[model samples]
Target: MDIDDFGPKEPTCRMLEANDKRAYFIVRDWNLETANSLRRVMLAEVPTLAIDTVEVIDNTSVLADEFIAHRLGLTPLIAEDVDKLVDFRDCDCEDSRCDNCSVTLRLKAKCTGNDVMKVYARDLVIESMPPSDKLGQPVITDADGLGSCIVKLRKGQAIDMRCIAKKGIAKEHAKWAPSAAIGFEYDPANKLHHLDLWYEGDDPKKEWPADEVRIDLDGGPEKTDEPFNYDAVPERFFFDVETVGGLSPDAIVNNGIKVLQQKLASVIKELTGVDEANAGLDGAQSPAMDGGFGNDGYGNDGGYTTPGYGGGNAYAGGTTPYGATPYGGAPGW
Candidate 1:
């Protein structure tokens, strides 16, 4: 099987602070199968002799860290461990918020006439409606629109807080065990990991149901015509590892290359017309022109003739008294 490394390439953390408080968060394992699958699709699309090797590592801990950073008014530290959290930073706090921990901006003005004010993730804009002091709100956005927060303002004041939404993947949010807390480690030297997938076989829980098994070895195995089939020996699927974390090794294995293969087949079929049938004519092959009365053309009287009612070159034009073109552009004119 080809290896895919779609996870974090560099392991480094960044300090995140909000409002004006300090807190702690930890890194947990991350789960990503869709990204892995998309990477495989890219490999299949490209022409290469060597198969793609992917190693995705998700520091699931980041999820909690993100939430914590957003909750407390403080900057988050970038580290694998909590000890990395520190008080020192480039900026310090002021007012109820902080320049280091929280961001604050203000606007002061009095409307002379009828006007309206609006604040969005982007620049403030006044619509057709007149400005209203009670409708102004705070707007925040990062360099990229990917990160942004918008709030309505009334009476010329607005305050807002941004945090990792509860909708995201996190223990406090949404965590799916046996599929959530999972990480992948690959040894390029050996090209193997602790986890593998099987499609047909017994699992560590004795729930063997794979149609195939894919063993991701840390090192290259000796060349052999035969591969280990989990279905044949249901006992082989039994790994001593606990399924307490993310997907059991068997679960990942069960999502074997076959599933990817089927997907690839479908993608290949779509990308390349290899499976499309070229049988018969793309357009129908009607009989040769027989200049019949049903032909469509100017009749003997120089009037546009309809099919089957034609007295023109119907026979030559494949329009006969009986072979008139249908209104829907059929055999008739």
Candidate 2:
């Protein structure tokens, strides 16, 4: 057996840790690989400081399709598909528990919500033991007013949630602070029902990979007196899932900014060994850690105070800017 398939790279490292946390994050071109990494980071009970939830809560409830497409990293072919919204009630499959109408996304963060309005998903990863739950069993992130609640549950649990709007990384990553947040207690005796958001789509790529077997040179179909027997066909065929666009152009642009910013922050950290807080991204100027503050407080003046909102007075007043007077007060005041 080749054990090298499971080694400690970024993905593997993420799968083994425990009790981690996050503040703010910005990543781009997020695909299943990154999403899988994130799943591990959440299950390992990692900590997150910012107000963002590990789960992407679908609040609009209208853009269920968009949220699923974002999580799956599926770029829609048609622009209108971006807004091809659907709700949980769109399904006519008798029971409302099937995927003919919904898609499920479950994530957990074992941390506190003390920071209310200051959470982000940057540099955050979670790990777990059995990975994800079988179909129909999903961790729902919806609970109370907790936009970023932390729950204690084993594998195969359900999570329902809603996340905050982020203006991307450029304007500072937004935290997942719901109108309210939840704090869960470990209820051992109580059995929780697994909740899943079902959707209508069948694609092999979305399904887990099947197990592979190698037949020996002389191997043939072994006759069995057993009640059941499995057959094998070495032929291969491929099928494509129906493609549809998701998210509006504005939303794509906005989300893209956040992703790029997160990517930039990660790269900068790798090259300079600097944390996001001190990297001059979140309002503060990057400092010249060489013992003295440089020209703009950063080495080679690399950091500059972000343009405006430093003192909560909006941009510096030169001439009446937009909806304000140059001096003080409201536009006309």
Candidate 2 residues 238-315, lDDT tens each?
Answer: 111111112222223223333344455568555433353243344221122333332243333322234232442322
Which candidate leads in TM-score?
Answer: 1
TM-score to true structure, per model = 0.19, 0.17
Can you give the lDDT of residue 205 in candidate 1? 25
Candidate 1 per-residue C-alpha lDDT over 103-145 given as tens digits, one digit per residue, 9 for 90 to 100: 2222122223343333333332222121222121221223463
Candidate with top lDDT is 2
Estimate the overall C-alpha local distance difference test score of candidate 1: 0.26
Error of 2 at 56 (Å): 24
lDDT of each: 0.26, 0.27
